[model samples]
Target: MCVSAALLLLAAVSRVTVAVTLPPHTYQTPYHAQVWSCREVLATLMEQELLGCSFTIISVHDDFSAALTPFLVALMITHSRPYQVVSVGGGDDVRPAWHSTSCDVYVIVAKRLLVLSDLLDTDDDSWDWQGRYLMFTSSSSANDLQRLAVTYKLQKTTDVLFFIRGTSDSELAVYTHKMYSKRSLKLLTLWRDGGFVKMVDLFPNKVNDLRGQQVRVLAVNHAPSVFSIIDHLGLLHNVSGLDVKVVQGLGRALNFTPVFHDPGADLWGSILPNGTATGMVGQVHTDDSEMGIGNVFLTEVRARYITFTVPFDFERACFITPAPRPLPTWMAVSFPFTLNVWILLVGSVLGLTVLVPVFGAGLMVRDYQELHSLSASFLLILAQFSNQSTRRPARTPMQVLVGFIMMCGFVVSVFYSSNLTAFMMVRAVEQPYTSIRQIVQSELQVGGYSDFWLAIFQGSANQDVRSLSQKFFRFDNVTKFLQSIISRQGVLLENTKHLEYLQKTFLTNRVGESSVRLMLEECINPFGVGVMLKRNSPLKSSADTMIQRMREAGLVDKFFKEVLQEARGPATQLSSNTDVGAEGINPLTLQHIQGVFLVLGGGMCAAMLVLVTEKAVAAGKYCL
Candidate 1:
């Protein structure tokens, strides 16, 4: 045991002398000077240009990130800027916090090329990173940078910078991506020649010139918004509408070629139960189309899945009901006066019939024997009211009473004659439904060809709107729906422009008379209508700019008017003899004067019944 201990002591002493003799082993520090250079460049850019901008650092903890993170934190502390650091262990380990944070700039630091690629491959669309500047620190080759830019579809609008660490500690290559050009990778190296660092623009403002790039657009054949003419082969020959014109104007101004595609089967898409969209919205969300434009309205639910441009137009949803029909001939006789006026006239006539007999008896001034009894007095007064000849009274008091009765009867007859003549000539119509409440109370069912019409109002705070939604129905066949409207079976809920289009195109007769008419009360006030695009689309800014300019120039309104006029064409022109009043006054027919004949027949029947009643009374008195 003692010999083993001495040997171990000798080996320890020899190892200590050998370790002391080894010439102070040293290795190069990874990215030592490059880290400092990056800190300096970032400090200058942030202080001078990116003031008040928050930053986010995403790192795969490594030797280089370990060295760079401390310097960045120190710089941020010195400038008193808010910054967050996210350490990624794997692709799935990326924290969702970084995605939701409101950071202006993002710096991704990783050692391996795979790590950087994996970090960028995350499919999170809720975060809007298109407007943010992205800086990548990796040792990947410049070619790899180009591949990443192309693969990730980083457009010129997105500022993507790469800081490539060279073999030596002092060597760092700064590059940016020019997405439209053939050589996408552009070098903007930081020159440090005369003991001072020449500041390089790390994030430069790039003009988003699409450079005649072909962008796919989703659209449908919605008239006035979009009218598509297709050939026999189902190939679209031409397209025209206010929305098409707007898109064409945008294409001209932005120097981009818009290739429109129809979102077949899914006309104007809707959100599904699974929180996914189908139709034009789905196409844009899936990156199959860059934008959608065909009278798409900006709604809160749709806005959650897509981005809408500044509204180029507005939509006023209205109800279209059947036109008021002409009043029946039976009603024309009574239409001259209201129910209350008719009641007052009857009451005054009866009251005078009773008073005339009493007055004749009390004053003892009766010259005619007909004024002695109630029945006889009624007949005499009725005859006077009918403006017929009546027996004259000799006494002054009786004459005065008769004159007053004549004056009242003459005034009422003159007013009734004038009113009846006007009513018969003008063809008065029935009262139409003027409000949504009235429509709800009516037997007419509210419906439209598109579900979107009623879907938008399902969540309304107004009780009337909610009740209307409950009564709403969606029709698949537009022809049937229009027929229902014409037959007064249903009331159509649609945009005002669309309702007008339908009236002019389908509901009008050869003489330009429409069977359907829009309600006076609007169901929904005017709200903005706009184009839809994918969330965080790069085309948003340029498209918005061009649309705003077109609006200012009044081109939008001009396009709308032109489309509507063309749609109307000469098919809906009013004929010269269309209006009855346009020619001479309309002559009365049997349909007009049938009510007067019926009144005469009723009077004859009443006279017969009175004669029978008097005979029965006399028979009973004789039997008694």
Candidate 2:
């Protein structure tokens, strides 16, 4: 009986299913939608296979809960009869700390997919799940998947597959689905499996002997976008007996294949005798990180090891900005007089003080002696007290002294009044005027119509800018509002700095210089500039290319001249911050140098005057 029971227990344990824990439920809508959608697609793709598997969607109902942490999730999943498992959402969640269970499959999603790909798994770890299956996924469905896959140490023949759906139908659909009217079903199948070889070798020099010979040798530069196609075709072309020659920049080649160790070392020289890499190059212009000017050499001479062609010397890049303009003279001057404001204030004070006293005395007037003399007394009082003229009135000496003192007090009062008015005007312009919060309380208008709307949504139409406004602030402008910010009194809630830059670009002393102005105490969220790449690719190399070619060709000088012209043109002016920054610095300085005409003319005149004096002195001495 004991032996029979043991056998049954073992059988039961073996039959137990594999289970997985899903992440928390508190993900933002878009994040939730992506995860759920991925799951939905995955379920549909492998629904039949997952039927008997016990899968649990483990997630926190709230973001603050410690219970939904990856450690706890792992503990829960492992408690059951673990079989195959997939881990998505990488970093600490799937570090080697987690003890490998009977389950073998693992999937990971990277936060910033392309950064630090070198640190990721680079060896063939697929066999760790030889009997089972493991898969990795990344949140960066754009511009990093290929490198991510390579870093994860996934082998070409390995069961692991990488997939990234495009954000638009026009994107991948262009090359994939719509490449051919009625595409070959077999070709489509090959492409779908990511099994098709897609690369081409172009030799501008040698054509015949290398035409069909398999070219295993390839040199890729920083352009990773060109790699996927290059790598795929490289394999096929080599197998087909064609000498495949891939001449490329540095960054792209490193990402495509991980065969070379220590990427930073060098590939431009004959360093790699092992033939893993043919051409190596050092990054050019170490000062400029953005400019793609890798200093490497390449040659076509075939060898058992890597080879390089003579460095493809290209032209240097040129950067430009709007030229400088002569600033308004008054702008540089401190508030002059502000005299009108002071005058208005003084007049108001004097009128109020004099009228109050006259009205009070008029009420006391009674008989003929008082009435007749009162008119004369009033006139005498005015003349003596105001001190308008030196002409003395027929009044007592005491009255003259008292009147003079009163006139001094009145003059001081007027001055005080003027100063008070000037202060008020300055204060009014300094107070809080417009912001996202203030916009809710008041009506506002915006310029750059489309961009203002698009920037808020991350370019998604489902959630409009108004909806975002309502979410952040309760008020809503349901009606389509026109650009009403043109009027001086109207308010504009905007990213002030951006508008400031745009103002210089589009409305500089041109037709619309006064079109828009920033109100006091108004600022929005600060935004930074970003460089975008094609979805599922690395940073585009052209930014680097532009820097290198220009530096080599000395076109950078010509570029500076052009940029200065633009920066100083009448239609546009460069903002102090934007044009003075590194990219635009050269152009801004060039404009100033070109506009030194006044100084040059003044120096010439001084020299001519000295020469004329010397000549006059010589003539006088000779005549004497």
Candidate 3:
């Protein structure tokens, strides 16, 4: 008993008394700043009780690792209580090995540095073997180490994982199970001086999510929907080894808090006033005049169910129509040119005949010339109809003839002009119109407002058309009954082809056919289609991060280009003219204002002209 007590005392004394000291360090000039920066930030935050004291660093040594080694040791030693830091060494010729120790004031230095190259040594099972805090400065292998550490939950308490990679794969795997079973591991580049701000903007609430209660995030293949939501909430990777049943079990166990939503537009202030804009609100019965799809909603609520990203490419929508035919020249002139023009000419000629009696031979010759002129005028009128040359009138000819010819030509010109003009008034120029099918087959949905009458017409009547292909929905007025049907109704029609053809032709032939198709089909014109969210929602920021990163990385561009190529490959115009680019957000008033502006301008011009005329008349300029 006495010997055992002595041995126990010796062991306890050894455990409590010895202080590990790292050699006085001279850090590499370039990496010293980052090493020290990590040390200082950790010290400050941890001192404030913001971070746990259990942070650890498992170093892989290269030259750069030597500089970073001292800081890690110093960080471990500075904690108020006993702590641990492990140093591991490996090379191509040597198998990787580790040395671990606990110290009251730990300051053990490593001869090597952590690099990206070391990541290659990791095994699938080794991810959860270590602590959370890791710095890979010396080589390229560090990114993998970081991923493994993150994936397996080895480095659980570290908030910021920094890496200086000579060469590293972006697809680093981390064992998140050790570091944190529940919280997500966010890997971002941290520079030596003060670059955390960049990451802060990208991930503002990351720290908060990490600080939340510990959770078990399971990935299940059996029930993807259930597991996805659970894993997402728990911040767990879908690649985690957990089975589908486990994931579903976890989901079933969790009391998912329901997200509350308010009635309004999304963050961008675009949402159809009709409730269809919001999925949770479900579909609502709306009238044609109410806010249909295409109304802008704020950004907050949208982030709840899905992600929202900026529109990278602009789209255009235009109605192509043939130019109108020009009106006949004669119709454009004075009305008298048609009927009385020739009569006046003839009367003038006859009056001149009276002068012939008084003026003898000279007057008679002039009268005869006048008569000849009339004859020429009459012939010219007839020539126009027969496509013959028009003869000029003589100085003195038959006045009646000249007048008659002029009148006939004027009348003919009027007839031609009026008839053609009237026909043009009703002619509907056939232009190639594109509809939703073309867009759907293309799989490139764009945003726009909804049409109401068309929604009802198509929604209730068409049994064959598949509406899910369209991603955008513009909302207008719809009835509650119809909304219920759209929300809950499903039908399986055997004779779908006939019904579709008839419905389409009937709707397309109507005036405002495009609007009708959108309204009725519910597929054509989705006004408030797509997801919207509140401006300030954290979800928006999260989605924005992924979207922005994906965009900058050129992923979205590739996706759309691929989709467009596939869609246009076939000789089909499946999703043709769907985009009506950036429609203005005026529910009403644009048309009225346009008419008012035109009328006002014309009235103002007329008033100004009348004032000028009155002033000129008062000055006695014209006496006729």
Ranking by lDDT: 1, 3, 2
Output the better candidate (1/3) by lDDT. 1
lDDT of every model, 2 decimals: 0.71, 0.31, 0.34
The TM-score leader among the candidates is 1
Every model's TM-score: 0.76, 0.27, 0.26
lDDT tens readout by residue for model 1, 89-126:
64344333443333367766666545555545556452
Q: In candidate 3, which residue ranges exceed 4 Å CA deviation?
A: 1-41, 44-308, 313-379, 382-387, 390-624
Clash count for candidate 1 is 0
lDDT of 2 by residue, 293-377 (tens): 1222121222222222222332211111112233332222112235585475456445534543443344444222321344444
Which segments of candidate 2 are over 4 A away from where they belong?
A: 1-387, 390-443, 447-484, 487-494, 510-513, 527-624
Higher-TM-score candidate of 1 and 2: 1
Error of 1 at 179 (Å): 7.0
Q: Which numbered prediction scores highest in lDDT against the true structure?
A: 1
TM-score of 2: 0.27
Candidates 2 and 3 compared: the better one by lDDT is 3
